[model samples]
Target: MQQNLDYQHLKAQIKNWALEIGFQQAGISDVNLNEAGKHLNNWLQKQYHGDMEYMARHGEKRYIPKQLIPDTLSIISVRLDYMPAHLTPYESLTIQSNKAAISRYALGRDYHKVIRSKLKKLAQKITEEIGDFGHRVFTDSAPVMEKAIAEKAGLGWIGKHSNLLNSKAGSYFFLGEIYTDLPLEPDQKQGFHCGSCTQCIQDCPTDAIVAPFQVDARRCISYLTIENKGPIPVEFRQAIGNRIYGCDDCQVVCPWNKFTHTTHELDFQPRNDLDDIQLLELFNWTENEFLNKTQGSPIRRIGYEAWQRNLAVGIGNIKTNEKTKQKIIATLKAKLDESSDLVKEHINWALNQFQ
Candidate 1:
């Protein structure tokens, strides 16, 4: 009876069930990722990954899906749109130096939880249909090459910025995977649609995109603020501007994002008025307050020190009235004695901006 089961029909059903379980799109692909592995190896060899040592840690398992999860014949890739509708324009926030400019993706609930829960549900639905098939769900939680797998699965193509792009959905989404032993029919891979548009590369505040499809994480604002635990590089501080958490300059300037869809997922919506808060307001948050406000949110992972360190840089970059400048200086000075060395270093640099 099991041998006679129709895997192709089951694949179609899995796509439908994924949408019903809150994923925007689902596609299947075989476990082959030789090309992606090569690209990854080249990127790692060039040391473009910065302090993200984990990107080079897993040997071949990071690209070879079956090696990571044995017997994984096929990979089911899914994307969920996370851009909230009617939010403050990212451009406006960048110019309003007094205001905090956070990456839109981190404005709401932690996506790791949201996408992981949805992936588990989709897997459970498949289990009910297939009777306990071997599968494991992942949402940015493993050494999975999610973007590469998604591209091969026909969900999208890897854009010049190294992010997956879809003509219909742009790049405002999160990716998840289901590694299963089911021999499902793989979908056709999507063609590269970026054309001659170099907006993402040209508009990167830190020039992180060194060339077409190549991003040096060491110079990337997102990496500096979020991934780099110590003080941000002095050269990039002014370029960092008011982006307190993560930078969206590349995505904001992408031509494809004109077709970006607003997510309907409530979990992706902004919480704690983060969408339009001031830099000073966030800078004033006590450690307990920061933890309380960011509970279950992605920003919590950065912890208070890095959070304050980023905000101090943002506050220092403010182009404001003399009165406002004095207030900012006072606020920055007040924290120096109490701050950790990391935060103290940033605060002092921010103060130097005034001199």
Candidate 2:
């Protein structure tokens, strides 16, 4: 059965099915990530990955597709635009400091679940046409160098901020992968188009992008708020502003974002008015309320304590009236006594900002 298959034609059919099933673009790539592996080693040696030990823990499995899944000859990479049609812009949210500025990706459902489900469907479609093929699907789930794979697959180029950038879709999307034993022809890789843009580097609130392609995760607000699980370093707290979940400063300022396509995925739309709500309103959520509201959303993974800690920092950064400041202080004081040590520390820091 495999001997008679037209692998190149099959690749084209797979991409078409991916588009019909909701992916914005799909491409294939040979499994040679040696260059990416070298870069990863250098970044890991400098401890740029911060507390993300899993990044380095995977050994060569991340860069070597065959080691992760033997007999994998090609990788199918797909992009799904996630930006909803309407939301308060990040620029406006920054000035309206009372409102939370979550990374737009998290305003809707978790991309991991959304993309994984679609990838599985894509794999199933391939099996129906080509018979049972060896394949595995992933979206940030394991040791996978998805960005490098996507770039190699010609979906986009890895921009200065280290996020994959498409000339037409910008960086406002998610990537998923399907590794298979089929000998699909690889697409031509895209050339880097960010010739002289320094906007993303200069505008980063915490200067996370230390260099053009290097991001120090320790100084990244997305990492501080979502991954750190401790008190955000005092130095970066004020700069964090009202971003309670993940940050989007780099993507927000990218010149290429002007061409970004808004998503039609209803699951990517904002929920609970999170896209345009006040920090105090989010800060006021009880543990149960936080859990209930963020159910199936990416924000829920950080848990309620970190949620409070992030909101307290956001409230402290609020540029509002004296009456509002007093109310914010009173609110922090109310939670300080009963909160966990981590939350109390951030609440205390918030009260100090008022003082």
Candidate 3:
């Protein structure tokens, strides 16, 4: 019982310290995640996870906190607002027609690095106060179900868009966790506030949301462009618009996002006028240029062939005019002879788009 008291005290101090470290809010929850496990299993059984085989690989280890981290008794979930204030998604979506739209989260330094650093610091601080701890920190690494844990920790409910929705902070934040042996008193779980609003479901361009609180990742733009390795399915091609990276349409249409606090992180701001660059310009980038420009950026992982493939789709979606059409067609044709079949197939499709 005395050890429990120590854990509770440490929990209080940690929450306060988390805010000092630039997190907007922090809360603790017990290790149990049975309810979330069931939902995830059902989603997977339906094959809604698509090409993300990692989701099914972990099995029950993902929900049972102690299984992932032995000696864990509670999870300390933290949220860092990343919206970067007043830079409304609505404005960005409308600012340019031919621009390739990337998700807001990818706009900064990768959250995996940023949030992991803060989580590790928080765990270290706990050791200084409580002598020692058995813990592991995570930032979107592994098979952790962050939205489920965040809801249990009183952070927010996962919204209809499948993003965690906080009434005060909205869903524009990144979540990180620290699994610890501390028996901290858990925070009361947050309630769903999405109510009757169907804005996100109605607004998805690809209709990826099959129903409230559910998303078919196969149709999700983010997964299609970033996760899928080969050709993008032809059915959804035109609906993809000019988005060559990740997509942000669901968040853009959410009314609650109006309250989202913009991020102050410099790493997330637009680079090389990326926020408004034309699709042809990105498609024209040499492989070496792609390497140098996207060195530390999230867009780098898709590799040169996939990068050109996605860009070709964007170019195909653009309005075809004499000069613009010739330039786009010429760009595709120039590299077709040497490019991979994936890039060549997209180039062929793009040429067909021209008059």
| Superposition error at 50 for model 3 (Å) | 1.1
User: Which has the better lDDT: candidate 2, or candidate 3?
Assistant: 2
lDDT of every model, 2 decimals: 0.93, 0.92, 0.83
Off by over 4 Å in 3: 1-5, 85-95
lDDT of 2 by residue, 1-355 (tens): 3568988789889999999999999999899999999999999999999999998999799999999999999999999999999788977897888888988999999889999999999999998897898999999898999999999999999999999999988999999999999888999999999999899999999999999999999999999999997789999999999988888989999989999999999999999998999998888889899999999999999999889999989988887778988899888898887899999988888888888
Give TM per candidate.
0.99, 0.99, 0.95
How well does candidate 1 score on lDDT at residue 346? Answer: 92
Runs with alpha carbons beyond 4 Å of true place in candidate 1:
none
Q: Candidate 2 vs candidate 3: which has greater TM-score?
A: 2
Give the C-alpha miss distance for residue 44 in model 1, angstroms: 0.6
* Candidate with the larger TM-score of 1 and 3: 1
The sequence of per-residue lDDT tens digits that candidate 3 reaches over residues 1-355 is: 1253566667789999999888999998888899999999999999999988989999989988777888988889999987654443434653455677777777656778888888988887787776677788988888788889999999998898989988887888999999887778899988888899998899787899999878999998889999999899988888887888878888877888877887777777766666657777888789999888887777888899888988888878886558767777788788888889999998888778775
